[model samples]
Each structure stands twice: as structure tokens, then as C-alpha cells.
Target: MSETGRLAVRKTYKLFVGGAFPRSESGRSYVVSSSKGDFLANAARASRKDARDAVVAARKAFPGWSGATPYNRGQILYRVAEMMEGRRAQFVAEVVDADGVSARKAGELVDAAVDRLVWYAGWSDKIGAIQGAANPVAGPYFNLSTAEPTGVVAVVAPPFGPLLGLVSVVAPVIVTGNTCVVVASERAPLPSITLAEVLATSDLPGGVVNILTGHTGELAPWLAGHMDVNGIDLTGCDPDLARTCEQEAAENLKRVLRPAKTDWLADPGLDRMTTFLETKTVWHPVGI
Candidate 1:
């Protein structure tokens, strides 16, 4: 048989949960198309049950991931950046198809995404010092406050700039000790799942970051309403959907980040990583 007669091995795109690739429990899939309406592939349409399972996985992984030293988490995240660098070509190709841009433009987005990861990774160990404070009290006591992770967070990635937006949102949450269940951009999810493959191979523990593809409006509500979830970021949600999710999240008093005008290419600063964090303060009487 001639080498040219070989059949290509098609990829089965599925949900990334608990560090393993699994088909959606509902056994449902939807056709994914390029920006030009060309057939790209089929992606799993995650159901409510899948979202629940992802939250459970995140809760289970929280203790260890959160307890690891800040420096350690930063190193692991930096490793993921390294892996992404190795797969630069593949990411650029997917970004081009997903974002409907020329190869050169896609390459730039991919480069920005990789640099974004490193930026967040560098912040992992330094967040506490920057965000924490030492109080000046009237009494003979010492007071200090430091930031801590708010447990499992649900994220809705922005619909545009799939790779860059996704990286911008996810990197900040996990780099600061929070585990996340991200509902990827339905319109441009190919690069997201490919990112999951990179995370799975990295030193990151399972469930630290889970990616789900489906109707954003469908998944965001359940995550917002989930009692176990500590926060919700609606940067990707449309106004109506964001409103609905915000209402649901209020039931548990979850920290809700409403959609805002964001230029992903601009300087991000520290807001994204700080959004999902909580402050802890301690006081001690002065010692002789």
C-alpha cells in the first residue's frame, strides 16, 4: 500500500475534567465550524451533570492545590507555559481557524497567550506581599492581613480572542491558589481543548483547571447556583445571561465578577488574580 493511501486519524473533542479526557455523560455533540462556516470538527455538548461533576472534582483537589507553597504553584504554572511554547505551531494554526484571522495575526495572539501565562506565574508567590497589609493599631498588638484562595471558581471565558481571552482568565484564577471550572467560548473552543491537553501533561494536579464546551448560557447558571462554588467570573457572558447568572450566584452569596470592557492585549495588572481571593487577618498582643 502506498503511504499516500493512509487515512488520517480524526480527533474526538471532548470535555476536560479531573485531568482526564472523557465524553460528555449525555453522549451529545455539536458540530463546530470555522469563522467562515467551514466544518472544523465536533465538540462535546456538556450537560448539567458534567458541570456538577467538574465542581466535585475541583472541590476534591482544592486542599492540596491550595496548600502547596506559593512558589511551587508558580513553578508548575511556568511549566505549562513551557509546554505551550513547544506546541507553538499547533496553537497558532488553531487560533487562526478559531479567530478567523490571518496566520500572522494568529501567531501574535498565540504569543501573547504564552506571555500571559508567564506573567501570571510570576505573580503566584508575590501576590500575598502585594495584597496583604500590616495595620497600625492603637493598642499594643500586632495585626496582619493576607490573601487566600476562595476555593472553586466558575469562569465564563470571553467569546472573542479565544486563546488570549481564555488564558487571561484561567491563568489568574489558578495561579493564586483557586481551582476553576471554565466554560469555554462556544464559538471558538478548539484552542481551549488543545490547551487542556497542555495542562494535562504539565505538573498541575487534576481538577485544578477544568474546561467545558457547550452553550455558555446553559452552563453558567448551574455553576453560579452551585453552593460549593465560591465565585463566578462572567467576563464571557452576554448582558442577559450575566444578569441571570448573577441572580443565581446571589443565592449563595458567591463572589460575582460582572462582565466589563476589557482589552486583553493591554496591561492586565493584578485585578484578575485578586478577584477570586479572600483576605485573612490575624492579631497578636505585643510581646515583652
Candidate 2:
């Protein structure tokens, strides 16, 4: 094929829901541009209906994912890291073009994202031991408290450092056995869409990590107020949007994780995972 006569084959990016890639229900799409204003590709523009569909998918998968053995969950998360590692070059290029960073910086970001997944994978089986407690009661009984998943979390991915920020918020949520609906960075969603491909092929069950790409402001309110959604992570929203979403979340007393500015490469600790967890205590009669 002559260079002058060659035609570029462009890819149409789609939403990742229920372990399947589908175009937005609204049948809408928007052009994604590189940092240099070069046309990259067209990404599905998710609407409120799409957000609702994602929530339904997440809720459907919650029981199975949350009920899985801790070791099994850890292995699935580890598989995510493995799949991500295999696609490092693709992610690095997307990061570079989206963020206008040097190849070295993009590579570093992608590496950190992969390592972050591995870190969360290691925490899957350990969180219960670390967060649960045994208590001594002043009666003929034994008492214990355990941490459990808060179902159907909705995450808004950070706009800056799309890849790293995305992995940071998502890895912790799913590692703890909570299914989630995530809105990828509106300006730089290519890397996240690509990551969805990674998840689909990993050992993760369907709908465990549903991803959407589009305007956060347009879809956030619907997710925040969705009666079935158990938690909302507003890490990607601005002050006003975050506040608005928090207020909506109050209707159902949903767990709300407010946005905070932090170095994405810093040690994240266990705060993110714990934020969406509920503690349950049980008492058993002694010497029955």
C-alpha cells in the first residue's frame, strides 16, 4: 500500500459494562483529542441511562463478587495486575499522548499503576484481619466485629494523571469485594477504556468493575442519587460538584468519599478501602 493511498483504521471506543463492551445506550459519541489537539478517536458519550445500566450491572455482580473467598478475590486482583503488565506499552503510549508527557514519565506512571494493583491484590486477604476485631464482654458471651463490603460503589476517576488516578481509586474498591461503576477521565479516557479491555480478559467476574467514558458532570448526579447505589467516591469531582453529589448521597444515607488532593504516587495506605466498608459485630453465647 502506498503511503499516500493508505487509510487509517480508527477504533471506536465503547463502554465496559457487565464484562462486555457496548456503545452507550444514548447512541452518542464524542471525539477525543491528544494533548497537542490531534484527533485521537471517538469515545462513547455515556448518558444517565448508561449510568443506570452500569449501576444495575454492578448490583447484579455484587453478591457473587462479595461472597467469593478472600483468597480468590486476591488472585483475581493479581490477575488484573498481570494483564496490565502485559499491556504496558499500549498504556504508556496512551498516557504519553493524552498527557503530553515524555515517554519516560508515561512509562513511570504506567508502571506505578500496575504496582498499585499488585499492592491492592496483596491487601485483599489481609484487610479483614487488620480491620476486624475480637472483643471481651462483661457477660457469658463472645463478641467479634468484622468488616464487610458496601455494595455498588460509584467512582469518578481523577482528571489528571488519568491512568494512575484511575487505578488508585478502583483497585482498592474491587479488592475489598465491592463491585463499582466508574467514570473515566473525560479529557483522557483512552487509557482507561484500554484498561477495561485488560479487566475483561482477567479473571475478574463480569460487572465487578464497570467503566464509562463521558462527561462526569452530566452523569454524576444520577449515580449519586441512585437508590440502589451504596457508596459514591467523588475523588474526580471539583468542590462544587463533589458537594452536590454528597448532598444527593445523603438521601439514602449512602457512604460518600469526598475528594482530596494527594500525590497519586505516594503510599495510599488502607484508607480508600476502609472508606467504603461497613462494620458488623456479632455476639455468641459462651459454654452452651
TM-score of each: 0.97, 0.97
Off by over 4 Å in 2: 1-8
C-alpha lDDT of residue 33 in model 2: 94
Candidate 1 C-alpha lDDT tens digits along 190-221: 88999999999999999999999998989999
Worst 10 residues of 2 by lDDT: 1-10
Q: Tens-digit lDDT track for model 2 on 247-276?
A: 999999999999998799999988899999
Report, for every candidate in turn, its global Cα lDDT versus the true structure.
Answer: 0.93, 0.94
lDDT of model 2, residue 238: 97
Off by over 4 Å in 1: 1-6
- What root-mean-square deviation over C-alphas does model 2 reach? 1.4
Query: Which window of ten consecutive residues has the lowest lDDT sum in model 1?
Result: 1-10
